[model samples]
Target: MNRFTTMRILRNIVLLLTVLTNIGCDQISKDMVRKHISYYEHISVVRHHFTLTNVENTGAFLSLGNEWPSPVREILLVVLPIIALIAGLAVILFKQGLSALFRLGASCVIGGGIGNIIDRAVRGSVTDFLHLKFGIFQTGIFNLADVSIMVGTFLVMYSFYKDRNPSPKLPA
Candidate 1:
C-alpha cells in the first residue's frame, strides 16, 4: 500500500478506537450504577460535596421533555439524535482539514450519543447516577455519557478558538 493509503487506514482505526472507548466507559459505569444503586438512593461519595444516586431519565438533559407526548418524545429524543450522530460520524470520518483534537472531540460526542441512545432504545430511559454540590453550585444528576459530551463540546470549541487565534512563532 502507498504511504497515503496506510495513513488513512491508521487514522480510521484510531478514530474507531477512540469512539468505542468512550462508549465502553459510559456503558460500564451505567451498568455498575444500575446494578448497585436503587432509584434516588443517595450515597455520599465525598462528604456533602459529591453523591451517587440512580435516576432513569426518559427525557433529554435535565428531563426537559419528560412530560411530552409519546410521538413527540420519540421523534425528538430518539430519531433526531440518531440522525445527528450519523451526520457527526460522517463529518469526523470524511471531512478533511479537521485537526486531531477536533476529530477526537467529534468522536467523543458521537460515542456519548451512541451510549445514551443504546440505553434509551433498550431500557426506555437513560441511567444517571452522579451528582455534585459545592457551596452555591449544584448539578443535576448525570452519568458518564453526559461528561463525555460536555468535555467533547469544550474541546471542539477550544479547537476552533485555537485555530482562529494561533500562537505567534518565536524567532528561529
Candidate 2:
C-alpha cells in the first residue's frame, strides 16, 4: 500500500480504538458501581464534597423525562441517541481536514452516547454514582459517561473557537 493509504488506515484504527476505549471505561466503572454499591447508600469520598452512591436515571440528563410515558422515553433516550451517535461516528471517521482534537472530541461523544444508550436499552436506566458539593455549589449525581460527554462537548467547542480565532504567529 502507498504511504498515504497506510496513514489513512492507521488513523481509522486509532479513531475506532479511542471510541471503544471510552465506552469500555464507562461500562467498567458503571459495572463496578453496580456490583459494589447499593442504591442510595452514600459513601463520602471527600468529606461532604465528593461522594459515591448508586442511582439509576431513567431519562435524559438530570432525569429530565423520567416522568414521560414509556414509549416517549424509549424514543427520546434510546432511539434518538443511537441515531445521533451513528452520525457522529460517521462524521469523525470520514470528514476531511478535521483536526486530531476535533476527531477525538467527536469520538468521545459517540462513545459516551453508546455507553448511556446501552444502559437505557438493557437496564431501563443509566447508572449514576459520583456526586459533588461544596458550600453553595453542587451537582447532580453522575457517572463517567456523563463526564466523557461533557468533556468531549467542551473540547469540540474549544476546537471550533480555536479554528475561528487562531493565535497570532510570532516573528520568525
Task: TM-score each candidate.
Answer: 0.97, 0.97
Once fitted onto the true fold, the runs of candidate 1 whose alpha carbons sit more than 4 angstroms away are none
Give the per-residue Cα lDDT of candidate 1 at 131.
96
lDDT of 1 at 114: 92
- For candidate 1, write residues 146-167 as lDDT tens digits: 9989989989999999999999
* lDDT score of residue 32 within candidate 1: 94
TM-score of 2: 0.97
